[model samples]
Target: MATEKLGIRVERNPPESRLSELGVRQWPKWGCEKSKFPWTYSAKETCYLLQGKVKVYPDGAGGGEEDFVEIAAGDLVVFPKGMSCTWDVAEVVDKHYKFE
Candidate 1:
C-alpha cells in the first residue's frame, strides 16, 4: 500500500553542527515537555533539535496510513509554511527554531 508522507525535510545529525549554530543565531532556544501535541505552522520554520526525539505526523493521519518523520538530537528539520501536524515527543526537548 502507498502512504502519504508529511512534507517535512530532515537532515539527520548534520555535519559540523552547522544547523545548530544557524538556529541559535537566528532565534531564542525553546524547550518542551515529553508529550504529544498538535501544531500548525503559520510561517515556514527551520529548526535544529539540540536534545531529544520526536515523531511527527501530518494532520488527519493515523493507523499507519501515513508516513511520519522522526527528528532527534542534532537533527535539522524544516516545517513548511501553513503545515499542520502532530508531534509525539518521546523525551523532553530543547531546540532552536526560526520562522520565515
Candidate 2:
C-alpha cells in the first residue's frame, strides 16, 4: 500500500519588507471583562482564536453602529478589505492574526 502526503501551499511576506512596511504595534492587554477597542480595516485580515471569546463589529453608518459577530477558540475569522470595525472582547482572549 502506498500513501501520499497531504500538501498545502503557504505564502509569507518577506520579513525585512514586512518589518519595514509595518512596524510593530502594541497589542492591547485583555482580561476577563468586557472591553471595546476601535480598529480600522485595511486590505484583509485573518485571525485565529486561541483563548476566550470576542465579538467583532463591522463598521456601519447607521447611527455609528455596526453588526457584531462572535468568535471563540478554534474559530477562524476573516475581515475583508475596506472594512472598518471595533473589537468587543467579552472575555480574556488571545489570537494570532495575519494581515495583508
Candidate 3:
C-alpha cells in the first residue's frame, strides 16, 4: 500500500527473491528500542523490517490516530526525501535500510 500524501509505501512479506534482488541483507542494519521520536527524511529511504511494529505520523497530523501509517515485521517500507514525521515504535525495531 502507498500513502501518496506522505510519499510512503509499504510492501508486506515481500518474496525472498525480491529481497535478494534488492540486496537487502547487504544494506546497513538499524535497530532501536521501543520509543517515539520525530524524524525527517533528508533523502529517500527504503528499508526492510526484520522485526518490529511502527506507526508513522506525518508532520502536522495533530496527533490524530487515523493520521498515522502502520508498518511491521517482514514489511518493506519506503519514505520519500524531505518527508518529516514522527515514528512511534510499538515494538523494538530491527531493519536493513538504504538511502537513495
Candidate 4:
C-alpha cells in the first residue's frame, strides 16, 4: 500500500522468496524501544521489519491523526529520499534497513 503525499510505500507480509531476492536478511539491523522522534531521510531507504509498530507523520503535517501511516512487523517499507518525518513507535522495533 502507498500513503498519499507522504510517498511512503508498504508491503505487508512479503513472501520469503521476495525477501531473499532483496537480500533483506543481509541488510544492517536497527531497533529502538517505544519512543517518538523526528527524522529526515537523506537517501531513499528500504526496510523490512522483523518486529515493531509505528506511525510516521510527514513534515509539515502538524502531526494530525489523519496524516500518519501505520507500519509493523512483517512489513517491507520504503521511504523516499529527502522525506522529512516523525516516527511514533508504539512497540519495540527490530528491522533490517538499507539506504540507497
Candidate 5:
C-alpha cells in the first residue's frame, strides 16, 4: 500500500473585505513594498512571510504607540475578527494568506 500527500490553496477574502459592488472576494498572492488598508469589523486575516518582512500596528489612539512587530521568514501572525490595524512592509514581501 502507498500513501500520498495532498493540499489545496483557498484564496478568499473575508465577507467584510468583499465589496457589495463586486460579487467575488479574492485576495491574490503577490509581492509588494508596503500596503495600508482599514480593517473592517467582520474581517479576520492571517499572514505568513515566504520571502521578506512586515511590520504590524494594532489600532489605538494613545500617548505612545506600541512598537512595530516585525514579521519575517518563518513568521506567522493572526489578526482576529473585530481587530483593526495597518500593515507596513518595509522590505519587499512575498506571502501566503487566507482570510475568513
Candidate 6:
C-alpha cells in the first residue's frame, strides 16, 4: 500500500537568500516556545524555524497512519489546513508563522 503523507511539507536548509528573496520575514514572527503542546491548524500555514528542534506526530485523524515529522532550525515547514498534531518540542522552538 502507498502510505499517505499529511500535515507537513519540509524543505531542508532553505537558502537564506531565498528566504529574503521571498520576503519570508515580512510575515509576523512567533517567539521561541519552551513548552511542548498539541496544536490544531485552522488554516494552512507556512513557517520558517529560526531555532530549536521539534517532532510533530499526526494523531491519525486525517485518515492515515500515525506518523511523525522532525523539524529543526533553518527548516521551512508547511502545515495543511485542519490538520491535527501534537508537537514535541525538543528544544526552544522559535519560528515565523503565517496563516492562509
Choose the strongest candidate by TM-score: 4
Off by over 4 Å in 6: 1-5, 61-66
CA lDDT for candidate 6? 0.79
- Candidate 4: tens digits of C-alpha lDDT, residues 26-88: 999999999999999999999999999999998876766789889999999999999999999
* Per-model TM values vs. the true structure: 0.82, 0.58, 0.91, 0.92, 0.55, 0.82
Q: lDDT score of model 1? A: 0.79
| Model 2 TM-score relative to the real fold | 0.58
Over 4 Å off, model 3: 1-5
Clash count, one per candidate: 0, 0, 0, 0, 0, 0
Put down candidate 6 lDDT per residue, 1-100, tens digits, no spaces. 1122454788878888978876789888886566678888999988888998988887774523446888889888888898888888888887888899
Give the 10-residue window scoring lowest on summed lDDT in candidate 2.
1-10
> How many backbone collisions does model 2 have?
0
Candidate 3 collision pairs: none
Please give, for residues 1-100, the per-residue lDDT of candidate 5 as tens digits: 1111111112223333333233222445556776655544365655555677665565662314444455676544455667655667777888656577
Task: Supply the TM-score for candidate 6.
Answer: 0.82
Model 2 alpha-carbon miss at residue 98, Å:
0.8
lDDT, each prediction: 0.79, 0.54, 0.90, 0.91, 0.51, 0.79
lDDT of 4: 0.91
State the TM-score for model 4. Answer: 0.92
Q: Which pairs of residues have clashing backbones in candidate 5?
A: none
lDDT of 1 by residue, 1-100 (tens): 1122467888776765575457455677888999998899999988888898999988755538456887889777889898888899998899988888
lDDT of 3 by residue, 11-51 (tens): 88889999999999999999999999999999999999999
For model 2, residues 1-100, the per-residue Cα lDDT tens digits are 1111111111223244443353322323223456888877666765545577776666663433334666676554556677776778887887556677
Native RMSD of candidate 6 (Å): 4.3
